[model samples]
Target: MPFSNKVPTIYDPRIGSPMLDAEEANFEEIALKSLGGFVLVLNDNGEIYYASENVEGYLGFHQSDILHQPIFDLIHSEDRDDIRQQLDINFHIPTSSPSNQFDIFAPPNSKYLERNVNARFRCLLDNTCGFLRIDMRGKLMSLHGLPSSYVMGRSSTGPVLGMICVCT
Candidate 1:
């Protein structure tokens, strides 16, 4: 995959699984092209797995700059510990529940250009891959929706996927 200034990194796809199906990849492309939306996938450990072509619209970052970075690095510190606790506890108990309503403010001097953003986080992998997707700029969170999160991860079959939480 190519990299850009908005995202400083990218990684090889997971070794075992087959590449995403054509229909799935096409669906992602449609999403990215429509609604001007972007997509991102983090591993159980929070490393960047894949990002949609339009990721910059939401993160003020490009997929190239995002690879290998812990998802928590993008989160606001004030909310990290509490969100972490929830993700960890949720893992042990096995619930993919939504969090209480809240917002994660854009960081000062942050990479993202648009201001007044927010997102609705989803625990996508509780049953299989075990990761999170911060849904951005949809009718989901608000007009300026942007999703981001941290995944410390857990073990599933073999991967050391941990825990994670989204700030807004």
Candidate 2:
């Protein structure tokens, strides 16, 4: 038998590449077609620092347009307090060692309602874009080497990275 050489890697048919360059990966232009949805990164300050290219399909705002904007801006006002409380609680919970896996808590009746949390919110696009509800799913972890403000949590040393999925 002839020897064959191929390195296996994580694959995404939508992106056509296992690993996207920093710029390409951050771009959410193709997020609309992805069943898995797009990725988002929020700093501990609750500001959006990174949004995949596809974010526009969900929120009608481009990634660049929303950068540095508070995540609360996208949330419906009625839900802000509840979501803020949940975020505070999440920020205080200590990470388990050995695994260091963080949790992403969503509001009641959310798409991934595995646990019971009182937080609930609707994600709306711009005023002119109309009403649209977006479901967010992601994890929280310490991300080093980011801007100082991103890591502004009371207890955590480094900036908290929220890797999330924006889904309709």
Tens digits of per-residue lDDT, candidate 2, 1-168, equal 211222223466896656434444423343346555556666555677777777675566777988888877877677566545544434444455222454334343133222122222333455544445455555454445676543453476433545343444
Question: How does candidate 2 fare on TM-score?
Answer: 0.52
Taken over the whole model, the C-alpha lDDT of each candidate is 0.39, 0.52
> How much is the lDDT of residue 63 in candidate 1?
66
Model 1 misplacement above 4 A: 1-28, 82-159, 162-168
| lDDT winner | 2
Clashing residue pairs, backbone N/CA/C < 3 A, model 2: 27-53, 28-52, 28-53, 28-54, 29-53, 29-54, 151-159
